[model samples]
Target: MSDPVAGSTGTAASGGAPLLGAADLKVTFAGRRGSPEARAVDGVHLDIAPGEIVALVGESGCGKTTLARALLGLEKPTTGQVSFDGAPLAYDSRALKAYRNRVQLVLQDPSGSLNPRHTVYEAVAEGLRIHGYTGDERAKVAEALSRAGLRPPERFFLRYPHELSGGQRQRVVIAGALVLDPELIVADEPVASLDASVRGEILALLLSLREELGLSALVVTHDLGLAWNIADRVAVMYLGRVVETGTVEEVLTSPQHPYTQALLSVLPEAQGEPVVLTGEPPDPTRIPPGCRFHARCQVLASGEAERTGVAQSCRTKELPVLSAAGTAQVACHWAAAKAGASG
Candidate 1:
């Protein structure tokens, strides 16, 4: 696989300008009862090139969803900027409405995303009606449905969400996004809820869509397996920040960050015993002072950092945010030190 990061240009894998990009993005929610603010997304920089698929992988509550929301303009950023086609994203109602039309969202639960009362046709046509599409609404809806793998589009036009299987409902949701002819799709856990048999079908559908439509995507998921299956690039996020990022082949096969290593170690196909970190992720309200992942870092706990004389730094000195627009990068002091020594 080709490296998606193009030095400092922040271009996509295709070497074209990013269809969507986030720079130093942060989202913070005010704490209640006079508590400190909770930083949902600290400082993330990610980009998706035209027709490229980038997976944002992390455990729950690590802020991958918040980062996705920020990219979609659903949540306002406390700092930083989101840009599409090289222009900064605007949050005003009119601007956002247009932005959403170009960048559609495909949620995880198709059942919840679709209205139980609405027929397939209504659900797919809703976007056109809202966007005031002047073209033939029926033709557009049918095309979207066909593209989404719902064959004989007219056959399912009148069907309700309850009438379709899990995979079919997901197709309808994807069709809804496709109907708008969006440039990019931000699918949050696109297949996490499906049966094991149905999961591959959905993943294949996503790949086919990318091939057919040249559509770029930012898939938010926790499953490294899913990332390996569909993503060209993978960004491993921890504690509201990206800790490691590179091509899927590079990052998954040889992950450098301890958090990423721990994640990959637990995969069913992994060679050795899993590396299980103790304790839950630290409270986001009061993140650790140095490396956000320091407390649970296995390398630090194993005395590797101590052997290398970077143990103290891991506990007290902070590392820079790994840019999402570069070659394989890691934020761990030990990993960087090891790389330097090897080089």
Candidate 2:
């Protein structure tokens, strides 16, 4: 069945600039009083080409959300920088409004995002009003609702959030984001809470919207299944850093990072990885030294050596960098060597 969202999008040619980019972005959060602060996002670089969907996949505490917040200027980075096209944004009301008009976010929860007190029209029109979209506001609101498949637009426009189904409410959230005609979207686990039947639809919706609207989207999802279905590129984040990145085909089929291998191994056969990592990741606050994945690394150590090796890795050792001078950028010592040999 054709997704309702895909059906709503207007076909158009892309004429926009690169939607969003983060160059050497770093975000560090204060830790305990005595200890050093942890780097939530450290020297991260990312690019979102026009009309593309890039999936930032990782476990819950991997700093994916912090990067997203940095993209939105919600979390101030200690170093590095985030920009849109070429304009730098400040973390203030004026800058926020400008960023809101140019870039938008589709939050995970549909119900929480839309105000129950406001009608659908009011909710969708909120960005337009805030961003000073003065010309034909009602027409624009109706058009956005129609574009999002809240069809027979007139009836749905006046309805409240409580009046819609879960899928429909999520669509409303998407419509609200789209109403401003944003250049980029930061979708933080946009489908994690939806029903199985609805998840694919949401993903397809996001992709189709990108095609029609020329939007660059950063999709945050733990589900590799969703990334495989829609993302053009994949970035695997671990403990606040990008451990691996490449085209979806390369990363999914032959991931180079040990953490990426561990993550892929846990996926179903049709998805990726057939070998799962042995244990849980080390604590983020006290992340091991040499290689973060060294503790669970199969080839790295024996019993006492395993613990000892982790300590050695945890020291201020010079770590290998992720490179794409191949299709994938991998950070693991073994995987990088393997990639080097193959190339």
Candidate 3:
């Protein structure tokens, strides 16, 4: 059967509510008393329905991690809200605990995330204990480890972080998340640290778990290939904002925003010469007066944007809000022109 979370039908088919969502989410960090505050996550809106895997793609320092933290309520948003199952999340201690029980996080580095001193059993059992699981803890831990593909489960129960291979350590981390039987998981750079051969295995495991358990996931990574490999949808982030969002095939194959185009151009499988963007990304403390990406955008740099006066608009007007463009939603003044040209 087609999974409801995989987007084969209407939202009602998936229980009429997004499993998790963020609306107008923003997170700002105070700088020195007089200095401008740093905008880490800026007005990001996203949603994950049941059983869906959405990849959040962006370069370093683009606030993907900050957005993830906000969704989990680990970092309170400076503005906007995170909703789960159609209701806004509350910050009360009891509410936060209940939210966390349903949404877990898998960090980028297994070696760093898992305590070297804790044996595999302890690490996996920790979440169960914290959540007040009263059933047979041993069975729960073993089932979680088994689900994460550490077969026999018993074989890995006593292994420490140093004793297991990198892949195995990552699995232990995943088991910890699974032990909670969460409805959603926010995985940050889940495979960036693993060996090339092991990365595919880990990704496959996640996809399999989604099929078997009906879990939703928001996978944060800079790897376009990873999005293509596993995600049903893709969100392209730049300078703390989402510039484009669509299915993996829609966004990757025919990117609408200039930043998205520039990203796709560099993919090894892409045929053209890499599109080298000019200028370093602006400091978060002083994001440009208009579109945050206007400074480095190739389209704006080219004379094309000048002809349509879009370049001037990009420099002086507020960044365009995301709007529909065929199958994708793109935030750009020049998207229509680019889409027409591509068509």
lDDT of 2 by residue, 57-85 (tens): 99887889989999888888888778777
Taken over the whole model, the C-alpha lDDT of each candidate is 0.89, 0.74, 0.85
Candidate 1 lDDT over 56-93, as tens digits, reads 99999899999999999999999999999999998889
Clashing pairs in 3: none
Task: State, as a TM-score between 0 and 1, how close model 2 is to the true structure.
Answer: 0.86
lDDT of 3 at 37: 91
Please state the error at residue 244 of candidate 3 in Å: 0.5
Better of 1 and 2 by lDDT: 1
Please write out the lDDT profile of model 3 over residues 186-298, one tens digit for every residue: 99999999999999899999999988998889999998888888888888888788889887777887787888888878887787789998898646787886678888988
Best by lDDT: 1
Question: TM-scores across all candidates?
Answer: 0.96, 0.86, 0.93
The TM-score that candidate 1 achieves is 0.96
- Candidate 2 least-lDDT 10 residues: 3-12
Ranking by lDDT: 1, 3, 2
- Cα error, residue 36 of model 3, in Å, equals 0.6
Best of the two (1, 3) by lDDT: 1
Q: What's the C-alpha lDDT at position 88 in model 3?
A: 98
